[model samples]
Target: MVKGEVCSEGLGPCDDTCNSKCTSKYPNGKGSCDSISNSCKCFYQCLQPKPEICNVGIGTCSTACNDQCCNGNCAAKFPGAYEGHGVCYNVGPSIYNYCVCIFKC
Candidate 1:
């Protein structure tokens, strides 16, 4: 596994405060303040590959609906992607839901 920096927030100079904030956000990750950037950076082992955003469109919370809309659209747009590799997530309130697809880059 490779260690990766997932989050970084600038909070003035390096101090105990930066360490505390990083630990609070990621319990399993290490937080250190970089003097060069003057930011608190969180480091952790990234087991899974980072997913790339494939497509975003209107969709419902139902898996069937999302599968039809998101999977179909993602396959059409990115033909090289493996079949059923696209995953759709429903976000926003119940009144207005949107589909977001994350697939292999």
Candidate 2:
């Protein structure tokens, strides 16, 4: 679950108006008005797992080679995992020299 705050308008005390605004914004979320901040605190379930990163450090390779390496490393690190992939990035003065694995947490 995640908690987020949204600004509330009007010069009156915090009331059900904040709840209505939050509910309209996030139908699946619950909200409450905070008197201290005059904002709406919303709590909702996370829709997706956060992405995990694995840096393979500096390396020299082509896009295809980097993709293969990242995929292999990510697979080794997260075996039997579903819904994950790898990406190749350039770093420093060299281009296409970094491997990063982005996978589901």
Instruction: Point to the candidate with the largest lDDT.
Output: 2
lDDT (tens digit, per residue) of candidate 1 on 3-102 = 2323233445667787676667656657777654466665443334654232334345464555567666656654564232344443345544445443
Pairs with steric clashes in candidate 2 = none
> Mind sharing the TM-score for model 1?
0.33
Lowest lDDT block of 10, candidate 2: 1-10
Q: For all candidates, what are the clash counts?
A: 0, 0
Predicted model with the maximum TM-score: 2
Q: State the lDDT at 76 in candidate 1.
A: 62
Clash total of candidate 2:
0
True lDDT of residue 36, candidate 1: 45
Query: Where is model 1 poorest over a 10-residue stretch in terms of lDDT?
Result: 1-10
Q: TM-score of the candidate numbered 2?
A: 0.34
Q: What is candidate 2's lDDT per residue for 4-93, written digit by digit as tens? A: 212222323566676666567657656676555565665443344443322333345575566777767656654555333555655444
